[model samples]
Target chain A: MNLLTDLIFDYTLRNIALGAAVLGIVSGMLGSFAVLRRQGLLGDTLAHAALPGICIAYLLTGSKSPLVLFLGAAISGWVATLVLLRIVRETRIKEDSALGVVLSVFFGVGIMLLTFILKHNDANQAGLDKFLFGQAATVTAEDVNTMTILGVFALLVVAVLYKEFKIMTFDPNFAASLGFNDRWLGVILTSLIVVAVVIGLRTVGVVLMSAMLVGPAVAARQWTNRLEAMVLLAGFFGALSGVAGALISVSEANLPTGPMVILSLTVIVIISLLFAPQRGILWDIKRFSKA
Target chain B: MEIVITGILISVACALLGTFLILRKMAMMSDAISHAILPGLVAGYFFAKGPDLFAGFLGALVAALVTVTLVEALKNTQRVGGESAIGIVFPAMFALGTFLVARFFENVHLDTDAVLFGNIEFVAFDRLFIGDVDFGPQSYYVAGALCLINLLFITVFYKELKLATFDAGLAATLGFSPFFIHYALMALVSVTSVGAFTSVGAVLVVALMIVPAAAAYLLTDKLPMMIGLAAGIGALSAVLGYGLALAIDSSVAGAIVSVAGAFFFAAMLFSPSHGLIAKARRIERQRVQIGLEALLVHLLNHEGEEGEAHESEMLHLSSELRWLPQFAQQIVGVAANRGLVMQLHGHLILTDNGRRQGQQLMVH
Candidate 1:
């Protein structure tokens, strides 16, 4: 009871919890679309590509505003996708190879820019390094508010275009045949992924955001075959992990919030993998043995 | 000197493992485990009685196994795809490592930045001191041993790796466990990643692993030659990337990755068999031959027509056939030069041999 009161009363802890939960839920929903389409690696590419955008955003705006940073990240991540798609379309380089090129080259550029900024503009770059490995413990209410706004906007977009996205993800050619304009839908989906990744940047960092995108979707996939159920379950699992991570990390100051959240997600994934009925690993094993 | 030696050793180790990685379509797994080994490194450091090679190796092994096991577990569940499993496991591990660093190991000498983008220039300073004697940089010995182990493994399991990579089903039928081979290869890759990462950082280790082997793959079909060429390319890129870092005074790993990318681009453009240029040229030649054949066929059909010589009236042929005027003229000029057609008062007449050729094409 005392712990509950402390948790409810503590403003920073509450904000952190809210931010992480919102991040988890939104990324979980968006990542389901990515994971189902077999474009899980795209999330990783978007996360890395966003770094240069974040740096460029900071350089251009000279402000630490999360929204501005996020916009910058979105644009760069989108461009990286375009470049990646173009390379794959125009050349003999396979998709995996193209992914590799875009991921490393863009990250290299981002690192160069970051080191450059650190060298030349040392004073203003104090919080910038935190973006590499997130500092979720320092999240404020305003940051949470920003994440909520973005999350809601993303959810609204996904809601409005849900059917088109569903068809396109499952069968792009069929979607095109049905006059859904699959290419533009692909852009929209990629945009959503970029937004979710950018939004998760402050909480999970670039390197670890892909896990947040993949973990919940993967966990939810074990529980259900239907997309809707999986999305909802992913959101539920993600939020649960987020809240638990936030609470646990706050309770023990020695644990970092971002890692705790991811670790919590990992635990959920393990449990879901082993125990989810029907499609669960153990269930399959038992069925095989019985048969 | 020591930095270069360390770089070459790491390069050879990565490139050797990379050939199989690229072949098995598991290049990104190497990337994932390289980053995922962070938590292992931290635990290794925390528990080690002394900072030694075995500690890093043990931590790396545990981390690699955890990564491989988690990925395999996810795969077995059928819920996560292979790429997605890799995507999930590494970040979780990396995040845990970061948290471990921030929480309990704050005062420890574990620098995350150093782990990500190593200071290759400083490799000479970290000398290995065995009580009374100093034997240059510790990275050389570390990377060298890893290289030897990788070379030995490849030599011993060459046939198994080849069979499993190219055709796992066939290997399985032959009584070889493809699953066992996979685990073994991943273990070697994990150990190699740890060795290479110590000198070049984990981020650039994947680049070192993939680019050389992929470039060689594009350049050749022979397995042994591919390995040899990949090693050569790796060595060249390491040297050039090192020189580039020296010139720009920037991160050596970044420069190395950039140089490897350049090599890939070069191979993509210039490799005779599989390069983009070669493909384009092949396509261009096929298009020209196809157009010429169509032109010849059209000429033969109109050879004895009563009026409106669609094949002879060059402008009409260009318009009716939807060919550019330039292309039409080029095809016509070639046909004339090859004695396939004769121009007479804006009418095309096929020679005897041209008629035979056109008849052959029509018959076929």
Candidate 2:
């Protein structure tokens, strides 16, 4: 009864829960594509890449507007993808090598830039490090609104392009023989990823954003084979973990949202991996005994 | 001095194991293992009551083993690719570790930043005292011991490692257990990574374990040479990166990675035999040689045609045969130099040797 009252009456709890739910849905939707395409670590790269963009945006605009900073982050995330692709295509370097290079180099630049800003005593830099680990209680209603609009837009694009995405992922040659333009499809897909990553970066921080992207999708994979089922299940799992994490963190003064959220996601994965009927560890054990 | 020594020790230890990791195409697993060890660190701290090296090693070793096993188990299920399995494992462990830190070890020096971007400069402060004698930074001794152990292990198991690395089936057939070697290698990698993390951080350890070996790979074909060159490259990157960080006033680990990246790109571009430039130059030379051979075959075919076709003039060759004038000139120049063809009133004529060589080329 008290929980129900807080859900409706406590503005801070309501805002945090709603915003986290939105972030979870967006990340889960896009994460399906990322994991299926075997670019699972791309989320990690983009999240880290967003830091310098946030810093540069803060320096240029002197505003803490989430919209402006997210734009900067999205742009840099796109640039990081471009560099990763170029390194793979033009050089003999492998995709993994390119990932490491971009992850470390861009993150180093961000660290250097952030340290520079702090040393200069910029008053605007107050609480900037919160982006490192994220504080859910601080999320405003305005941020929740922004998250809802962007999440819906990302989901709409995914729905509209579902056929193209399926064809492109399962068989690019067929898509290309149909003249569907693979590179353009890739750009669109990556942009969706960047949007998902940028917004979730606020709630999960740079380090844990990849978990948000990968964790739920992995859990969902144990339960289904169809893309539609996977996407829906992943979204459900993501929201469940997100809300659970928020509620858990709120129960304790010292607990943090990002880690708690991640822990919640991890629990779902373990449960799914261990007992999800056909694909579960318990199923394997049972089959082995019968055989 | 302690910092530099520690850097060198970490660099060499990582580079040694790195050679095998890169060769196995499991370089990124180092990244995975590095992040995944945090839970073990936290567990070790809580259970062992401090940052005990033995306890930390055991905790991290269990975590490392679990990480590899889970990744392989996921791969065996055929549901997730190797990369996806790796992507799913480390973050979970790292997040768990972070949560543990926030909940219990907040006031302690079990810092995530220190784990990620460890400071070599501060190693001097963590001295090992032996009966009132300062034995220098604790990390130096730990890292040096690890390097020695790595060297000795590789030396003792050199033949087995070589066979297993090059051909697992052959090694297994010959009574060397490839699975044993594989686990042994992972154990060394995990231990080395932890030792190195006190000075260079786990992320930079990945840089040391990969970039140096990859750079050396661009410069050598033999494993022995690759190992030697990789160690040298690792040491050089550490020293050079330290100087750079001092100059720039930034994180030394980051600087080390950048320097190692610099070495990788340099080797990629300019290695004498395996480099991109050398490959491009060889291809260019091959193209010209093929073009010259084609010109010879053409001249041989049109040996005596003085008809309206204007068979062998430079302009005729450029227009009729689609050869550029400069290319025709180059072919002609080569033919003339070899006494294979002669120019007669701007028309081409082949000598006996040229006709003989062309007919021999035709037969082949």
Clash pairs for candidate 1: none
lDDT of each: 0.83, 0.81
User: What digit string (tens of lDDT, one per residue) describes model 1 on residues B1-364?
Assistant: 6777778888888889888887787878887889999889888877884445578778978998899998898777667888898888898899888887877677777777788777777898888899979988889888888889989999999999899989999999999999999999999888888877777888778877888888888899999988988888888877887787677666677777777778877887889998888989999889889987898788788777776365578788888789999998888888899998888888678888788899899999
Q: Give candidate 2's chain B TM-score.
A: 0.93
TM-score, candidate 1, is: 0.91
Q: What fraction of correct interface contacts does each candidate retain?
A: 0.51, 0.30
Worst 10 residues of 1 chain A by lDDT: A86-95
Q: Residue-pair clashes per candidate, as listed?
A: 0, 0
Q: What tens digits encode model 2's per-residue C-alpha lDDT throughout A1-291?
A: 777678678998888778778888888878888888888888887887787788788888877777877887888898988877766675566677667667766665666566556767558688665655567778888778877888899999999999999888888899999999998898899889888888887787776788788878888988998988998888988999889888887777777787788889889988998889798888888999999
